[model samples]
Target: MKTDDPTMLAAHDWDFPVPIAYGPGRLAEMGRRCIELGIRNPLIVTDRGSRDLPFIGQLQSLLENEGLSATIFSDISPNPVDSEIGLGRKAFRAGGHDAVIAIGGGSAMDGGKAICLTANNDHDLWAFEFEQPVPVIGQGENFPALITIPTTAGTGAETESTAMVTHADKGMKFCVWHPDLKPALALLDPELTVGLPRTLTAWTGADALVHAIEAYLVPGFNPLCDGLALEGLALIAKWLPVAVDEPQNLTARGGMLVGSSLAGIAFLKGLGMVHAISHMVGAEFNTQHGLTNAILLPVVLRFNLPGQEEKVRRMAQAMDLSDTSVEGFIAAVETMLDQTEIPKSLGEIGVPADCAARIADKALKDSAARTNPRVATQAEVQAMIEKAIAHAR
Candidate 1:
């Protein structure tokens, strides 16, 4: 791996940061953290599916014991739309919440973050959509304090400063960005993820791996992110299967939770075509995000290998591949996927062939495309999609 290409190393800017309270029993400090952030009346934002969880009840009780009044806002969907954020803002205003306590998976966490911001604003949320030649997040200095408690080990939404909210009219997932959108604190408790279903374990774990891989492969000069991504990949490779196989294994769960957060930090440099394509497909077909990334990763790896051979070689070494070639690295990924019983193709996950062109068109316009090592055309992305569909397991 040569480091002569300064072009590949250039980056707009760089930062390595996040405030996290991480451990197996870290949820115990959630209310205390909220109180420290001046949240007397906190809005608990989560998806409907998680509202009934025993932990939710426990969390409410804990807040009550801490002399905090809490309101439950679980009206978000798996892929939260802007309208849902609007509804959540209404809920926040009606409840007169002073702060937000976002809990649950990526969807719930992202929706909560958006809801927290929108609660005090009277303008449309779409005004914040990340546009190129400009920053991803627009100018917004005012926002309520937020604390995130992730119930899943993927999506890294808890660790990022961006939110992916669907625009109902556009029917596409758009990112809302703000430096202030980052939660003041993140609590990572492996116990929260111990009960994740096997299917979700594989899906979200794969999503975490994709985040690391794409971040490593994306052309950038952020060595800190690159290092984090590599370590994250190694952690996922070693621990994801253990987690999926033995759901109650705290060590594996904790490794995955840390790996997922590290991956989130890594992608702050940028993500590549895997995310671009995955976001489009997820918005269109209502597919699971991690599943889509898992299915598309191999194909995107192959697509990105032309000018990125050295980076892929480094990734192979990081993944501990016996064969350091691109093909060998991809083969190792396939074996890992097979071991986890993750489906091999987009079609297997209910993505339609007819939507490939549209997905490709949208993917080319995605913010992630700007960082991809391989500059892909719409036709090339479409061909990759076709190959991914044809190769579905």
Candidate 2:
């Protein structure tokens, strides 16, 4: 299980956080890991959809057999807002839960993480917004121990310290971050992902690609992230199609899980415009985060291509494309999108033309936008949105 890449090893040093349990059939280890971590009373936070699955009941039974009593909180929505986080926090405190077991997709993991953070903090959740002009002020040390078991292979929520939640009032997504919020453990069981539908497979798989591409392109000095991003991109390029077409293919599923995690780790260095726009659009429209990002990625790439020629060339190499130019890269991505049956434009995915102005305004203020290689203005973002919407039909 050792990687020869020094950068990958460096990225996993003790300082990086998240002890991962990866591979097929690793879901059975969750109860043991919880016990080893001394979590006697655990809150299982997930979406309502996941709660209905047979695996959810099986996991709870496993925990009870291991002497860990668990409570379930599955009222959260696909785009978790502050109200949901507030409810989750209340459940955490009222149930006397000592730790969090976040299981399912991105929304469940993020809602659980937010609940864990706010359960101990006295201030409002937005007080810790990562996009603010000044750095978030907090005690930064105390939180319920967290374990994430991802049933899907997107968002990389299992390993990252940042959580995205929509503001109930503003209808905008904001990231709350603290080093203590990083999960104590991440269990990736590909067997759990075998039931994913083709559309979800395409969306989540494309979302992972956006993370890797943005992380690699963002101007930074972190070689560890660069190496991991390149590797992640390569893996996704090779395996995502196979995974989408053949859901039961363990090798493809496993590769996607690992690639998604690597992409998440790489984004610790930060993301770029695709995430910025995707967050805004998703919060307002309640669209799927990964699908929104997938639709916007090609245009965002075109917008950022002016100064990123050299990096795109390297990315082309990683993607194993014969053409190493930016145009070639964009074409390859479009081809991938077509192959995956992804919607061609924002309009196709229900993002309206009228939201263009609002999305642009929010995108400019997003933390991810600040790290974009090429500075993007509201006008430019609006133009991109228009193009994205028009191109869909």
Strongest candidate by lDDT:
2
The positional error of residue 217 in candidate 2, measured at the CA in angstroms, is 0.6
TM-score versus the correct structure, for each prediction = 0.92, 0.93
lDDT of 2 by residue, 36-74 (tens): 998999999999878888678988989999988999999
lDDT of 1 at 310: 83
What residue pairs are clashing in model 2?
none
After best superposition, candidate 2 residue 350: deviation in angstroms?
Answer: 1.4
Candidate 2 stretches with Cα past 4 Å from truth are 1-16, 132-141
- The residue ranges of model 1 lying beyond 4 angstroms of the native Cα positions read 1-16, 132-141
**Cα-based lDDT for every prediction:** 0.83, 0.85
Model 1: lowest-lDDT 10 consecutive positions: 5-14
